[model samples]
Target: MTCALIYRGNDILLCRDENDKLSFPVVDINNYDNSEIIYFETDGTQYAVLPEKTAETIAGGVWRGLRESWGELEPKTWNIAAKGAELAHFMQTNRFCGTCGTALVKASDISRRCPACKREFFPSLSPAIIVLVTRGEEALLVHAKSFRRPFYALVAGFVETGETIEECVAREIYEETSLRVTDIRYFGSQSWPFPSQLMLGFTARYASGRLRWADGELSDGGFFTRESHPLLPSLPSISRRLIDAWLNGEIGGK
Candidate 1:
């Protein structure tokens, strides 16, 4: 499975790393020769420092000379260099060891190395569980307390230490909904680069217990049928796919 880097959404946003200071790591899909920086009356060459806005503009599906229809953008779908500015910030901030406060060096295997302590620090990504809980044909979703009213989403939480992925899923379900899951079927995963997270999406059958909201995470919880589906969060998201599988049958695309 290839993951996309640039988020054009049909509008493109170009990126540049002048002096390696900017964060957006956009590959020149056009593959223009960018050997040296030179200016001219007209663009001397097609090659140029990809401005951040170019990526965003193409992402929005608007072009200065040409145009495209309203369609989903087909991004490169792979970014070995990474995406989102915050990830760059994370790398920069965490370069120093918090324990000893020493400058770090980039390691060979995508991590920062400490010469003194011989410690290798990698880019940290949070593991979050998002489940599509079902009871019979109806699926469960929750309205998180902090969110605007009526915005329903799946039961999701960050995984903690000393917990298996399954354990985290079970714990999150019970803790948030006061409901237990009898079976959890692995559905799929997605890379959410808003910060950094590997989302593990699952489908769980509701075993027992009634609706109960724990703490401030979920303000409301309930079941919804396929026809009257709640205004759930966006699809193209792991959480949405899991529910979509349950509603439309896991095997067939709907």
Candidate 2:
């Protein structure tokens, strides 16, 4: 029997045992003998991927999106599910070689090769910068126009061509809020695989600028301290972590 992460569109299948603990279902690997299923191993656990239609045929489980299941799953299980979903997405999107029209073959567990073009392709990751900008004690938080909810988050943007991560951090803040920052320093990073992104985090001090945000990009922008900040992002997100660190006097000072 092998533990498997069953996927459907953007949801994963999970089962609850008698103890009410959520887990990926364990299935006989041979059951999917002819279907196109993905298989991989990590930290000594062998895992497989089950298509929605096939997995639905099996009884006893509920399908839930990764975001909704974040608090329910153990850290290890959540990481495994996240990795499986990312790999499944990559394999599904990269079925053929871009250089040539030839079908690609498994070059390795995480790579594919085009036999004709002799080109190998791996899972693509887009790196983005998320920063916490400080002015004395207040942190800069912005409400993007695209956010589904009205919650405010730190300044962030995808790294652009010819620009370093540090440059991206400064540019994102300036472009979005018209605020310049200094003392740009590394804070931490997170694997934000909402379709594959590596979030690089940083901390910076406000340099000088009045709040004049780019129209259509931000709805509101301002600096706020721990007690006065608006509704923030939830825990387990690097954004929240950065905010917590600032609130707790972990990182900030000009």
Candidate 3:
């Protein structure tokens, strides 16, 4: 028997047991005699993944988007599900070779290859930077226009071509909020996996400029003390970790 992460489109299948505990749906790939079960490994853990159409033949579980499944599944299971979703996205999107019109086949546990040109395709990872900018006792927080909830988050953006991650930190900060930052330093990293993103966290000191948000990107933003900050992102997010670190005297202090 093997544990599996089953996907229904972008949503993942999670089993809710009689005690109301949620877990990854148990799937024995051996039982699905006629189906193709894509397999992947993350952090040295092995898991199988299958699409909703194929998963329909199996019994049980409710479908949930990864965002909704957070904290519901244990931290380790949630991470495994995240990796499964990323791998699923890769499998779904890379069925055809970009260089040629031929279909692809599994090259290894982590890649696909075209039968015609022999080009290998691996899961794509987009790197993004999120920074907690400190101005003395206050940390910078903002509400992005795209947020589904009314919580504030740190300054963040994807790394552009030809820009270093540190440069991306400066560029995204300035582009989104018109603020200059100094003493930019690494904090940590997390697998965002909202369809494959690697979030790199950093801490910086506010260098200059009053907050003026770029149009169409941010709804509201400001610097605030720990006691003055509004609603923040959840514990599962790196944004919250960075903010928590600042408030707890772990980083971003003189």
Query: In TM-score terms, which candidate is top?
Result: 2
| Better by lDDT, candidate 3 or 1 | 3
Candidate 1: residue 84 lDDT (0-100): 31
lDDT of residue 42 for candidate 1: 18
Q: How high a TM-score does candidate 3 get? A: 0.92
Local lDDT at 154 for model 3: 89
lDDT of 1: 0.59
What is candidate 1's lDDT per residue for 1-254, written digit by digit as tens?
11112322222232333653222333444443322211111122221233333344332222311012111222322122223332343454576876577887766424577878878886688899898888877888788877654668789889999999999999999898888997787788876654577888887888899888875688776988777877876535676677667677662222
**Per-model lDDT:** 0.59, 0.86, 0.84
* CA displacement after TM-score superposition, residue 207 of candidate 3 (Å): 0.5
Model 3 misplaced regions, further than 4 Å = 17-20, 33-35, 42-45
**Number of the top-ranking candidate, with lDDT as the measure:** 2
Q: Could you give candidate 2's per-residue lDDT for residues 1-68 as a string of tens digits? A: 88878888778899887798988888887878534778789988789887767776567888888866
By TM-score, the candidates rank as 2, 3, 1
What's model 3's overall lDDT? 0.84
The stretch of ten residues in a row with the least summed lDDT in candidate 2 is: 29-38
Clashing pairs in 2: none
